[model samples]
Target: MSPTPQAVYLNGEWCTSDSACVSVFDRGYLFGDGVYEVIPAFAGRLFGLDEHMARLSRSLEALGIVPPLKHDDWLAIFERLLASTDAPDAAIYLQVTRGAPAKRDHAWPDASVRPGVMATVSPIGAIDGGARVITLPDERWGRCDIKSINLLPNTMARQQAVEQGCDEAVLVRDGLVMEGAATNLFAVVGGRLLTAPNGPRILPGITRGLLLDLVRRKRLMELDESFISIGALREADEVFLTSSTKDIWPVVEIDGEPVGAGEHAGRAGPITRLLDRHFQALKTRRSDP
Candidate 1:
């Protein structure tokens, strides 16, 4: 496919992707000293900007990387990018790294280095019925809480999944389910919602939060937000996944093996359809002219 020209913002200036470059000596590059967040824009509106920014702030705090601008200042830049982007739907990529310093050292620079911030927008696409996933042993750091720039493990996991003909890889940590490489996993057990709770190992997901609330509001089922084992997922009544990009998708199969109720149990289950409606309602409400 041909590459598309997307606008990029870097260190307080707007430019094309090629023009938006950072120094190779930057700590974010040399030492992986940075944090990033991806905000989904659906129908020309940014989904959960506040939540994403909040997580970004938390990541920066965890890494002790001071933000170059206040949260409001960051919002102003996002708004500009959102308005200027031509796509009807897109994702906003935000990254902040401890700026380039004169030398490379394990310790922080004597003076606080400016945080390098960049933003970019790209087109969005359909979610479909969700993609198949392969399970892989978790090799990521236990502190998956912070969304830092250290993504080599995640990259490898996803690539492994793709090689196995899957869309994503569900990371299993010692026989227990952690999450997907880029999304959160959910399974219905006896009509109850179950997902890994937010902790040092799991990154809290914005769309997962919204969907769980929607399910509760409808009195359909309750979410446990507790850890579940691979056995539990294999025996689940229904299985699904959520993310800013994919929204809600029922996992009809795993590793070519049936998941949940077995052989497409949750494809269009009653609860699944209801949540799908609620998801549509959310988008329609947000997209109203």
Candidate 2:
């Protein structure tokens, strides 16, 4: 793939992608002491950026790291980067760390390590029809709510899914479905929507919120977030995964078992179709003005 022509904001300067690089001594690299947020942009406008930024700020506070830039400053920087890039649909990635210091120790740095903020935009291709997912035993820490950079377990799970000829991996904790490795999981059972509740078990996903809203707006049946077992998913009316990059992707099958195979076999269900249209309409409206 060609390198994206997106501009990047580093420290204080907004420059080309090639010029963006953090210091070797950055704690984020040495100890994974940082947080990041991915904001999806449709057409040319950022979608739910304020929420993303709020999450980022919260992550920083949770990490005891001050935000590198003011909220408005960050927005200005993101807009500049977006305008500099040519991608119509992009995922804006922002990473803030405790900054670099010329030492490696377990203790936090004594002084304010300049928070490192960097961003770039790239294209989001068409959403796939459906995705195959393999379930993995959840091995992440209890603080998954923090959105920290320590993603080894998730990385391995995602890679394992790829190796297993699947599009994504759903993480199961103690035989209960948690969420996807990189996305959130949802299920339709008995014509009702089901998903895990917001807690330490699942990272609150932006697309997940949108899907819930769309379902509510349609007056379709839904269940308050709760634990869903893998066995239940296999017997459910439908299964799907949502994220910033993929939106809502139906899961016709999981781990070789067909979900919602009777009438909605190998296709997006009615609820899925409805939300898909709502999501697209939102994108179109944003793309227009």
Local distance difference test, each candidate: 0.81, 0.82
TM-score, each model? 0.93, 0.94
Candidate 1, 180: how far from true, in Å? 0.2
lDDT of 1 by residue, 129-239 (tens): 656888889999877999988888889999998998788889899899989999898877887889998898877888887887777787766779899999888787777
Candidate 2 lDDT over residue span 28-114, tens digit each: 888888998889888778887766877787788988997778878878877887787677888888788888877888788865568
- Clashing residue pairs found in predicted model 1: none
C-alpha-based local distance difference test score of model 2: 0.82
Where model 2 places Cα greater than 4 Å from the true spot, the runs are: 1-6, 285-288
Position 52, candidate 1: lDDT: 87
Instruction: Give the number of the best model, judged by lDDT.
Output: 2
